[model samples]
Target: MRILFASSEIHPLMKTGGLADVSASLPVALKRLRHDIRLLMPAYPQALARAGKLESMATVTLPGFPDDPVTLLSGMLPGTRVPLLLADAPRCFQRAGDPYRAMDGQDWQDNHLRFGLFARLIEHLSLERTPLGWRPEVVHCHDWQTGLAPVMLGMHETRPVTAFTIHNLAYQGLFPRHAFDALNLPPELWHYQGLEFHGQMSFIKGGIAYADHVTTVSPTYAREIRTQQLGNGLDGLLNHRAESLTGILNGVDYKEWDPGRDRHIAANYGPEDFSGKALCKTDLQDHFKLRGTSGVPLLGHVGRMVPQKGVDLLLRAAEPLLAAGEAQLVVVGTGSSALEQAARRLAERHPGRVGVHIGYDEGLAHRVEAGADIFVMPSRFEPCGLNQMYSLRYGTVPVVRRTGGLADTVVDADPAGLKAGDATGICFDAALPEALTDALTRALALYHQPDLWRRLVRTAMAQDFSWARSAEAYATLYRDLVAARVPPGKP
Candidate 1:
């Protein structure tokens, strides 16, 4: 099947989080499965400069917004056979540093206009009858940034079936209703059944309302988002489309994350030897200037420091845990001034007990995964996280909040020891500091029991959450969607 996978970000090109990783790895995996897959994203100046595809292709202007003509650029994605189409419009996309941000660290206020335009361009390209025909059988939209694609397709006279995947529900791309004219969205789509949300235009709602299928990262999150608590206000719409909604758990790119071949870490080790992991642990300690001790369990967190990630809970639990001195903490990744300041303060208070790196370092992240005894992801609501899976691959037990993908992935340690060999990590219910404390205490206690800890590590490492498996599942879904399009008796 010919598939057009649309996402705002792609790894090794423009990545801020796991969405980019999924966008890049999944398409490559699908291509390997013999399906013709093409990727569509903004030709950010940085990406173009890196890929060496700055030259312009065809310049096409939209109907409503005639003043802005978007230039299309064609290039092969680096390290992949799939073709890439970049929608270039310097006024809309060209900015310093990151694709989504300026050098001064501010989001482009015209993001709504930018992405909406990209969606419109995609619809036009797909529906246009050109000599180089490229009509996709399936148009897969990733996250809210590209959510407008499905909506635009539904409004158009296009035959391509649309699929929308919710990587994160919290960011729904809600813009003022007046911007509707700028979007060039049809009048008929203004109603609640389409893109309307309250008095604003919701990109995510449009995708949910119009797409043939809606998917979240994990099955448990698929169920959770239907409830008011976790839905971030889209629960009603998701509940209405519950039958069409499916949760497909995301998988990591084992080639990039596997400790066996990772050159980023101080030492490379796999399940066989396992001794190098300890060396990595010591290296991590030395790197962070923390106490280089193997007896105390080292817990690591690598992600954006924000309330959504439950960083506040980590802060609350830090002092007590450090005071107890049973375990050490190492946090990587940066976001939210409040969280960064708090983490840094905690590190200052307990020098060797807490190590906080207030920035993103890919190499450091891999080292943390290999070295840490436990990986902590206390997210308040995680759609589908990749780090926990990375931790599992690195033989690090994950201590996660029992919500969204975390609930789906981590099998809690059996209290009665009934499922001895199967348990992967510690899972907590409440998204509070006390709950996190309790879970940490349990993990630290288990760390002392070498046999149990080893069993947990082995169990986690044995699990396979590779993109190859995920791609196969997606292929089946795509084939099914295509088969449904066939006439009743036609082969």
Candidate 2:
């Protein structure tokens, strides 16, 4: 299969969240399955620097983009042989603190324009408009950044099979109705059933409405988005397109996350011998200045400190435990000022019992996974969280809300599940702080039972959530979509 994987971000070169990680790993996985996959992303300065030994491929211009000639650079993704295509439009992508946000943390005012041009680039690549003459049979678009690709391709009578994955529906790229004029899309796209959402132009609607097939990160999330509560106002359209929707759970790249050979952690350990995990725990305690012995359970949270992550709920739920000296807390992330301040205040109030790191550090993230007795992810709505999977791989039992991939992956440590020897982690229902607190209390009980805790850790470590399974699922989907379009004798 010839696949064009389009995403706004890719890991190692550029990353803001799990999307980048998925964009990087999934293609490599597909390539391992013998498919010819090419990654398409903007030529951000960071990406250009990291993606080594490039060859200039072709140049093209979009209808409305004044940046007349966007050069396409071809390179191999670092550490993998998968072909990488970079759309080099310096004025649009070069000057960035992150891909979507300015240095001040405000979303870039011209995001619609930035990604609109990107959508056109995807169209060009999908249609084989470039001089390079290689066309993708399947163009798999990720998130709203590449949402317009399916929309653009949908206009043509003959085009490649398109699949769009909604990483998160909450981030629908909406712009003022007037902004659509700048994108130079057909006037018909202004209709309510098209790109228009209420009075705004929604970039995500392009993919959801026009793509041949749609997917979300997890099966639970696929069902959740069809409801009014979690749909973020797009439930009707989603329900309308229900037959074509799917929820393939995202897989963890164990090569990077496995604890046995992780270079980032203080000590390497696996499910069989957890002695090194104790040294990692002590090192984590020393690093965080937490004055807790290995006897006390150390809870860990690593992600954006935002309301959606249930950071507020985490603070409220864990404070009582932290204050009582029953357990210790260590949080690492950067997000909303209020939540960041609250985490710092909790650390201050409980001095040696709480630790807070305000920004992301990959090495520190690994240490937290390796060190913590339990991992906390009380997301109000998680699409498919990777850290919880990382926690499981490191034998750090995850305490997660029963939603999305967390629901799909982590088996609740209920008596029935434990008795059947199937429990991997702890799960709680509801988004309330009390629910999480109660779940944490249950985890604490389990933590005190050394033999049971060790058994649960081993169970978690033994569970497989590798990319091979996910890649196989994707390969099946691609073959199905492509087979429908191509005649039996046609290559």
TM-scores for candidates 1 onward, in order: 0.95, 0.98
Writing each residue's lDDT as its tens digit, candidate 2 over 1-491 gives 88999999998889888999999999999999999899999999999999999999888887788654799999999988999989899889998688999889999999999898999989988888878788989999999999899999998877899999999998999999878998888999999999999899999989999998999999999999999989998999999999989999999888899999999888899877889999899999999988956578999999988888999999999989988888999999998999999999998899999999999888899999999999999999999999999999999999999988999999999999999999999999889999999999999999999999999999999989999999999999999999888889987
TM-score top scorer? 2
How many residue pairs clash (N, CA or C atoms closer than 3 angstroms) in each of the candidate models, in the order given?
0, 0
Residue-wise lDDT of candidate 1 within 1-491, one digit each (tens)? Answer: 88998888887778889898999899999999998888888878667776654445688887655767888787778877878888787777887756656666777777788888878877777676322367888989988788887877776554788889999998888888877867767788888887888889888887888888888889999999999988888898899999889899998888899999998888889887799899999999888899976588888999999899999998887678787787799999788988999999989889898999988887898899998989999999999998999999999999999888888788888675426567888999898999999998888888899987898888888988988888888888887777876667864
Q: Give candidate 1 regions above 4 Å deviation.
A: 52-57, 103-105, 129-132, 416-418, 489-491
- Candidate 2's C-alpha lDDT? 0.92
Span of 10 residues, lowest total lDDT, candidate 1? 125-134
Error of 1 at 9 (Å): 0.2
